[model samples]
Target chain A: MNAIAETVMLDSASTSVTNAVVMDCRIEKIFYGDFLAVRDSRVPIKKNKIIGFIGPSGCGKSTVLRSLNRMNDLIPIFRFEGKVTYHGQDIYDRKVDPVVVRRYIGMVFQQPNPFSMSIFDNVAFGLRLNRFKGDLSERVEQALRGAALWNEVKDKLKNSGLSLSGGQQQRLCIARAIATEPDMLLMDEPCSALDPIATRKVEELMLELKEKYTIAIVTHNMQQAMRVADTTAFFAVDISQGSRTGYLVEMGATRQIFEQPQQQLTREYVRGEFS
Target chain B: MNDSHLSAESILQAVAGDAPRNLQRAPLEIRTLKSGALTALTWVMAVLASIPLFSVIYMLLVEGGSRLDWEALTALPPSAFEAGGGFGNAIIGTLVMVGIATLISVPIGILASVYLAILDPNSKLAQTARFLAKVLTGFPSILAGVFVYATMVVTMKSYSALAGGMALAVLMLPTVILAAEQAMMMVPKKMKDAAFGMGCTRTQVIWNVVLPTGMPGILTGVMLAVAGAAGESAPLLFTALFSNYYLSSLTEPTASLSILIFNFSGMPYDNQIELAWAASLVLVLIVLVLNVVARFVGRQKF
Candidate 1:
């Protein structure tokens, strides 16, 4: 219904998105019921880059990431003021469907939650949901190949997606997200459940995926953000009033955020000195 | 004997004692004795609870077993002055009416439950639907019969199998909806969230994730409802009335196992009494099979 937003979305599809903002969350506030979960300032996710959000336990890294795709809208109490635009179209706009927003912005959860369906079906799920007109098996293979899991799971594509190892299941989830051809991917602590070797594999996959799609990741592991993120946003909890609230402390090139963080909180967090 | 994640040294320091062996593994302590006494009491009470059920089964076997023959299952019932016969027509009619009830109830119950439990659970309308469904579960079967009698039977101007089924469907709908709502609710939020994240609409999530995962439990509820419907005579009394002949049309009078038993048990003739006993055996056997089937269905076979 917003004519300007619709035209911008259409125009962006044809134009080069180099240095362009694919998704932006310039929110004034994020609320879950009455609690101020995130006192949001501007946190724009740029095109074709992995932006890793890192913070303490209560800090709203995942909240910001979820808001990017309007995934927070699924939570009954989740309410936000201000724009979360995908391709310059305000996703929270009354007419902009969250279902459509999600199709363009995929998410991989903290846990490797493969549907109870088979591996091939799991990858094909999104495409099927969108009624994809392509050769489904080929797209599933391509996505699986893209996630660097094709060789391991290609032979047993018919098996339950849950039948794979934890690492492979995570990769299968990656394949599933990409098969829908989303312009971006959001991962929430994707490697927390994995071993060091598996974590390394996922980290590698993220760097590879950044070439084709924008990525926003929330991670507890600072070293992981250092490894994979092009830009890193450090969030910190403000506990001055007894009730805690998370806010973006600093967002810069990953190196600067790690080596020369502008904020004292960022410095303390990266140095593992949380008081 | 051995240690894994928590080494023996850590375990010794953590427990400061003999571990699981130290943790109340006494053979004859007073607390242990009390637990054993309670366990014995539980088993006794369980057996006590089973007594009535087993006794009824025993009574059916002793009183009804003799007349449960091939002819009693496949042949038409005898006339009032006749000697020996079967209630095959009754069996057919019962199956047909229950089939209709199931057809009516299953979809409506499942869809309405999805609305109540999944879509708008906290809404006032959903709350009212839930409350009404619970109330209906406790509703008297005779009341259901009366409702159908006014709405269906009087309008149709004939005691028909369709009317009987409508009455049974009313009785069944509440049970199916409640059980199914609970079943759908029990599907993990994680699974649904995954579906939603994959760009599925709410309807898609319910159809693709919620229903499949909740299916075994839903089937159990359905089978229970079916068993309950099959055993009701009061609902069929005014709605279906009775038919001694084979059910030719769904719009005509029908005979059910419950009604046959109800009718023949009060008859003066010995043959009719024997036929009633045989019918009771059949009905009990049907309910027993349904319970067994429900168990198998309830298990996560997938």
Candidate 2:
């Protein structure tokens, strides 16, 4: 009976977690010192699929995204009780190096934060960090091409990464991430700082990138989730205890969550009905 | 039972049809005059603040301008009873000792600050070191000389250039460390985050991202510390003592511009007094150049 119950539970998640290769992990809790920030998030990211996390402001979507690659470890007060695994290995294990985890699961932040280096150097940073023995120029070119920033930036590879347009700089950052050949990419609202044209370009890039790398993005735009995501997770704030903490309300196919959500909160959010 | 809706035009609300017009403010001239008064007050205070600085420059130029010759910089200091000699050795000594002090303090200060501001900033030891650095910034310079006099001077069994440099290094450390910490802290969190997200180790982040980004500010701090160390006389008084001739080695007594002025100002000879003024001018110029360079370096974008 317990085995049947577990099978039903796994089926309910809808992403079908039977494939045990990559991005099969769950987050139990994230804390800032003693206060619980986010809890019980169970959207196991799948391979070669783009998953979008959509929520209102301060709903811990970004926080959840940050925890995936162990980026939250940079904060001294940040604490976590979670199993974030990659390739069937628990990343938060004591023996695992956060640096190595970061290398394998690359991230792009909200702001276009290209290091203060030439465009070529920006892309080459990750490659150099891993001490890649391949042809560096060829690798940088491939990463830039993969990010769709090659045609515009190929001529000015020596220019500072900051000299590019905001969208270009973000693309440059993406190039920087994939240069190390990470299997998964975590992007935290990568287009919030950009304009409409740039946003469109980035959305297209994400669709193309899904052919190769698993992607999880946190976004404020519901239309964005509909446009690009294969699956979507809705995070909502819980304030019953006079404190705001975020929890995942539902995770399902993007169309199902938008059209016929299982939870009332998800329904209200999709309809833009709740305050 | 009394939950009646109150609409805009209900309950004898009689004045609801008119649109809101432009609001009146204070008369334009009165407002302008008030702003002008504030501006004038600031200008007056600014002039008042600059009076002492300008007066000092004027005094220095009048007293030392004519006496500042090539000879004053290239010749040895005049004796108590003699005339027409210069502090060539003192200029060389000041540069050498200040160089030594800079070499000793900058690396240590920058590393300590990296620990305080970047690596393990919240640890009890870092907090204590930060506090101690702040306290030492206010500690008396004479005490630094006295402390060095007890340690290096006593152990080396002589008053030497090395001792004076050590004394200045003691005074320069806190300034360098504190200023460097502020600079490192000012490096954008995003840049460091980007570097870390790129899989940089802590040391790699410091070396590649933090240090290079903070270089302008760090250089500014180091230059300011060097200026402060250059102008200090009390620290060198006991540690380096004074010499009339050129330094033979790092172990012998050294002559510095500040010490030269100190020794010459007390002499009864007119030429010695004039040389003192000249040395003061050079010292002031050195400090000014260092400050200007700090501003220049600090203003760089990357």
Candidate 3:
């Protein structure tokens, strides 16, 4: 009777675990040294949803994005009170490894930080770091293809990543991030430094990627958020005692947030009535 | 009244036209003062630095001319002042000592530089080690020689080639450490960060990206250390103990050009004095050659 009960429990546990939420961050506060940066945030990230965080400058939208992958942990003085979970497991648990968390959630920085290495090597970097000893060339090609940069740089794999134009470098960075086959991607104003054409390319790429992986993007461009994000959250800046804090004003389906914002401030900001 | 207003309008337009052109002119006094001061300072600094260098070279070439014969190049160091001889043994011994010293110092210096440059800049141990390296760099050369003498020579009961080489190594270490560190520091941080972002471990980033990028600087540093090691006499004086004969084994004492210079400079004989000058000239020329070689190797347009 005990053996039969154990088998039944195992079957149910495995099925629920398969449908687990990818990321959940409940952050009460983010402090840099003694100054608060962001506050009172709770976000549940479902698989393959493109979530957008949009706000004005100094709003801590990027701060919240970085915290999801523990990228802000690199700063020596960065401190936060938060519970960030990945795949139903607490990511900040004492026994958890940061490297493993990063492996699952790749990030593209605002500036195009392509490796000084060749374009091919830049794409291959993440895969090699994870010790994926498969056909490196094929994987690099696939990543480049996914980023929509293969046609421009396919013939010049040996060329330096820095040799590319600004838009190309950004695409190369995207390719590098995706090369590791991460389950989720974080982009911090990825298209802000790009031209209109490049911005459209990146937007389209984000839309395409939502079919495979969950994505969270922090953007100041409200139009961009409207175009690509399925779910949209507005971050509002509040400062006290020279310390800045950002709180989420409202979050809902993108169409509803833009068309029928419930918050008066969100409506004003979205309608260009207030900065 | 209408005619007067039209006249005033034409006059105002003429003044406005000239105003922009007049405003474009540079202030003459400021430009003249800057050029004059720059010229005066350049000449003053150039002349001040050239005087000492000119005098030393003039003295070496004039006093040492007669003694720098082919015989001096071939003959061995004489045990007595009456017997005229050359610095062949000293030259060969100097070469051997410097070679061994280079062998010991270069690897350690380059590795330490790699650690300082490519490793965790945030690590407390690395920071403390850098501070210690700086302190060691300020330690006196004579002190280094004495330390080596007390440790290697006195304890071993004799000054061997090994002890001399060790003293030279000690003298070269600080220079090598500082130079190598600076060279490594010149490598751009972007390169290292890019390598890290790719998933390369700390060691891989250093070996593959950082070291190669900083290679030219490392070469220049090692060469500077080698050039410095060539003229060092104080550290080797008590440590290596000087020999008038050729050296073949690590256990035997070795004579170097600096020792030869010290001994010959004190002799009353005119030939010995000339020999000292000739030896000095040769050592300077060797140093010049090494620096030229280093510069040649390190020169990169980019």
Candidate 4:
């Protein structure tokens, strides 16, 4: 590592780690118009750690992530019986504001969704919406730099964000997400649509970001989990008893889960034995 | 056979050394026939549509030419055909009624659209409201005039410009709602999600993102409604009551150009008929300008 990398790591280490857990969701049940999506489940998210949720498509991985911030509330038919807490506060409490929770827990979607605006405006959008009164230009610059996008777009800040290449647009979305200084970043297959080189750059950004914020990522790519995750959770669909709800098969440190899984399903999944 | 194959191979090698060429090009005869048919059909339809429009405009200019004087356009309203006055009061009266109608319809229509686009997608009430708006759009204009006459004019003891404008507004409400709703629906869902994800409320998302994005469409809808109001003679005949003097208030009986068009066109006097033709030309011109403005606004991407 170079001097700048060393300095960033050192400064990050010096800051006392938060003992408070990031997300503690105990979902009793999740439903989509009378269809139970996820059965009873509990997950404890550690602070400042990268937790990867690896599962097959339609296994309710994205559904769980959306529930963490109450994003599913927008769908009128989406019902749930759950108790989710962040920093020990009940997130589903009637007084709690999902909008405020979403602001604090930002998300980057599967596809790059930079607003159809200038690159600078895309980064500054969340900040302006949240009514951040500080130096907005410097904040935007810092966010772009943090997202590893500042060098490529430094001189073209006024250009449309939509005009950027796909990889750059994803990074611009990351820049937009971090502009608000959220506590945790939830990324849903952020690199699934990118090329290998772009994926590598995003992976590097994620590793660099782990020192500062907690991240929960849902991915279909197992190698991605092996590469960037500190902890990994394996989910499997239960087709028996006419129940297709996804359940957490196993979870452990990335090395232990890959090397010695507790459940046969997890082992088989890790070795690509069954989907 | 071997000798023939060897000779073909030699020819192929010679051709490959330069460039390969297509042995079979498109049939020139078939392409020529198709192009000829298409070109003839295009010209025939173009001329067929253009002729009636040009001829009507030409005849209108010829028949209404003598009455297009400055005095005829600028002078006050005349009760008698011998007075030879202009339809100035009628023009002003038309403008004022349309303006009031636009003001009454725009806010209600846009609000209804916003509600339908944002709130009605998943709700049964919203679906019902959408159905009602669609049905209301196809309602007859004369029936609207009758309804307003029964409700407002009968209660107030007289038909007034306010009653006329109200009838027009009722006729325009469904159109304005439907057009504005379509505009609001064109706003990307991702934009709304981004706004809401930024800690903004649903109301804030509608106001800041959806409304601004749909601004040009809302303007076009309002313009169409106003223009459609310009040609409605049936609604105004019972409401405006054909005044001979200037309209000072909304509640007073007023004479609009459409009402005058209907009344003067029925008279025995030749002068009144000429005046009616001039007013018709002016009405058509006003509607034409409004449509042009709407088209220009619709072309803007924002």
Candidate 5:
């Protein structure tokens, strides 16, 4: 094992008794009907830390992030040959229900997909779906505050969720995800469509959210990884005889990955030499 | 002459002065003539298409206007050779039978469409069902009447409102299914993704998100089906036959506006012919009101 893997394994072992590893991906290969999409990937996600997955387009970072919550199961042709575990239990086990798994691990997509519903209803969607017993208004308020969207939307709670600006819609989606109080959150290029100011706001929200919930984000923006991520995993594409496959190249502390990458590909990627 | 040295305003003034004092407009090119001809042809085609509908309405209004009154709206029809009666019972019967048909067809049609668009889309069974539905839309209304005549009327041993309603329901099923399926298909796929990502089960996603978003469209389809069912006379002729009294039960013979219009228009009596014209006008008005209400309801926010 390399030094980064060794360090991650040590951390995993040290925190095993406490079950601090929120998710562990031991993905050997992912296939879309016999076409390889990702291969030979192993990543350990710790609790209450923001981990960034950075790579060029078509490197399978989003695919890998989606698999953590079993969102890829929706695709008819998608099949993966490895295990993804949540809190020491293999989520791919036959008895494990994906709906239940998703309840504990929420996701924010690339586009700001707010439902065609009232603002309050959007924030309260997951809570209502999971049959939350607490005061619904209070829980919605708490979630909105958690996402730093409370003040902006407090007066327009009854307005359509689609009526908000794109940035506010994304924040409402964040509020909706966190309202379920999931143990971990997965974000797939959450800020790619936002303006710079909105992107900064979302990045700041991610930093604040990491103090409570574990986060794994896929981003094409290297600077975004540098700013918000505590640890960064760099994925690279491998092309041989026309078929391109993606695999994890290196992962370590953000400073180490950006300032002193251990692998040649990582060095080249961070130096902007080549993707 | 020194165009390069002149400012833009001076050049514009000079060119304007040098331009022809009485400039003639350009003649129409062959392309413009062809396009204008095509536009006029389309307008003519549109008017020709509407001629039958407008003429029918105009004939109904002109011939029936003199006889239409409160008495005609509230009284039963007179005997073939006699006069001084109305088609009130037929109006009530039409409403009741169409209401029954709506209740029967809307649920089954909407459910089948849900299955086609959401549950098993692209499956061989779904494709076959959709193909058969499209074929059924083109199936003759007289064949629908014959179907009810064979199955329900023969089994019941009598012409009754129930049999008539069943026939109309059969005629309406394909339209409701096709329209509702289209509306359900238009529900954005991203909405489903968002729902699933929030930990909702498939059933919940369909019930809470899909159905509500598609409800207005489905309702509009249902209204259209109801209007179409109201205008069908062949099925009612085979099943309900005719009754001069108001509908008392589903198993009883019932009178409807279209059947009244059909039976009366062929008679030699002038009074019955006038009554037929009024009934035709009332039927057209009913259909017009239904379509207008559908548009109004469809415009409401879901």
Candidate 6:
């Protein structure tokens, strides 16, 4: 275990020289009031890379994803031990504001939740909230283009965001997230509600977006993880004596985790032997 | 082979003089009968409920129609036993008093409701405020009048339009707060989550997202409060009293349609009585128009 830690530290130290470490999460445990939700986890999200979290239902993948950006702080009962650092600053420190953390680490939810406003307003919402001083129309256009939705929606910018199709709405949500220019994006099952074609589009968009922002996504679809993620973490729930608590099983390069998993549980998971 | 087996099974059933026992059951005629009876009953009940409304409207049109005229609408009430007068001053007075009341109550009510629905919704103070608002909705309109009479009219040393407006404001506040809170609460939680996810401050989310989304419903609440305030006669009696002339200032006693109807309805003169009916018709029309406007506004999408 010490050797493994040494190796991981060496690997991270070498990677930090070339690529920025956007978020370094060392979550000892997470609790919803008195109930423990997630056990220990250690994951370092690299800059400009897609990191996928694959786990079965109730394995706390989304919980860990949310905690990275302090999105879990919205729930009054939620509390976590240990530290989450963004750009070498402890985000969970007393002086740190969760709102500020969220501004820097934007999130996209499972279901596409576009505000009931014009398409332009939906993309411009985050920018407006942050009081973006740049040219608003140009910024909105840039965001829509970044999400690959500008051509389809440019003519109907005045129309309601809800008027868009399911796939387009998800892309709009992505545009809304990126408009604020956050350094990292946390997506929790973003493609779960979308169709296959929409899922493909989103996967392609994720690849394109990884050039500019770090992304951490939690998904149930292992194939999606294999397709889009550079790094993958497998999570599993321990239901010993009926006390269910989620813990990280393994983390490695996507191909290594899928093809030559170091952990037996990860191998079983990748083999589709058991959820 | 399948057809031969089916024919054999049919032959066996025919020999038994009844179709296979598990194959089918008798049709449910009772369901159709009960549904038909219930649908007819619902129609009958609906018609019965509408009868009183239609009858009141019919009475208003028949009794007040003869008194209505261009002059009646644009003139002040004549002396007792005199003819060819209207409640024009009363109409203007109602508008002024209700308008003032709306202006006072709407901002207070909407802001209070936003506090209850969005800010510190579970706090002890908000819970108390919510309970008080619910209790206030059932407060007697006459008591509202008396409240204004004591606080404004008595302090100022006379019944005035300002006092009347204050009384109506009190009556309207609770309704607006309750309805506005409900409307704001009806905004989906997911929308709020989305707003908050974008790192919007609580105030920004409420103002930019929640309020706009809930505007139609809030407008309906405001319109309903205005309609209720417009038709209130008991509250105006102590605060507004009665006036025969056009309103000079808010400090002076004002004429309202409800007050005019109340005062003239009891007079022995036929012309005064007819004028009272005319005022009642006008008051009803105003309330009806307000309700219709509420529906129209409520139907609008954000």
**Candidates ranked by DockQ, best first?**
6, 1, 5, 2, 4, 3
Candidate 6: Cα lDDT at B278? 81
The local distance difference test score of model 5 is 0.88
Instruction: Give the DockQ-based CAPRI class for model 2.
Output: acceptable
Task: Select the stronger candidate by TM-score from 2 and 6.
Answer: 6
Candidate 4 overall Cα lDDT vs. reference?
0.83
**Tens-digit lDDT string for candidate 1 (A1-275):** 13333544575677665788777788788999999988966788888899999999989889988998888998889998888777667888999989877877789999988887789988998888877776889989999999999999888888888788999989989999988767789999999989999999999999999988889999999999999999999988988867788888899999999999888878988999982
Each model's lDDT: 0.88, 0.87, 0.80, 0.83, 0.88, 0.89
Candidate 3 lDDT by residue in tens digits, A1-275? 23323433454476465334567888888999988898898887766789999887888898899888776666768988979987567877878765556766788878887765789988887777766767899999999999999999988899888899989899998898888777788998999899999999999999998876789999889999999998899988887556668888888899999999999879988997765
Model 1 clash pairs are none
Model 4 misplaced stretches (Cα beyond 4 Å): A1-15, A18-20, A115-121, A150-165, A195-201, B1-73, B78-85, B265-278, B291-302
Winning model by DockQ: 6
Clashing pairs in 6: none
Model 2 spans with C-alpha error above 4 angstroms: A1-21, A133-137, A151-159, A238-245, B1-29, B81-83, B289-301
Model 4 clashing residue pairs (backbone): none
User: Candidate 4: TM-score?
Assistant: 0.83
Candidate 3 lDDT, B1-302, residue by residue in tens = 99998888788778885323354646477987898889999999999999998887788888876778877877987655466689988888888888889888888877776677655655787788778877986777788789988998889989887888888887677678777777778767655544544445567777766665666777777787788888888888878878877787777888899888998899888878889999998888778888898778766422
- lDDT string for model 5 (A1-275, tens) is 13323444565577775437678899999988978999999999988899999988888999999999899999989998899977678988989999878887889999998888899998988888877777999999999999889999899899999899889989999999998787789999999889999999999999999877889999999999999998999999989737889999999999999999999999999999986
Docking class of 1: medium
lDDT at residue A179 of model 3 (Cα atoms): 82
Error of 5 at A193 (Å): 2.1
Best by TM-score: 6
For residue A109, what is the lDDT in candidate 3? 79
Docking class for model 6 is medium
TM-score of chain B of 1: 0.88
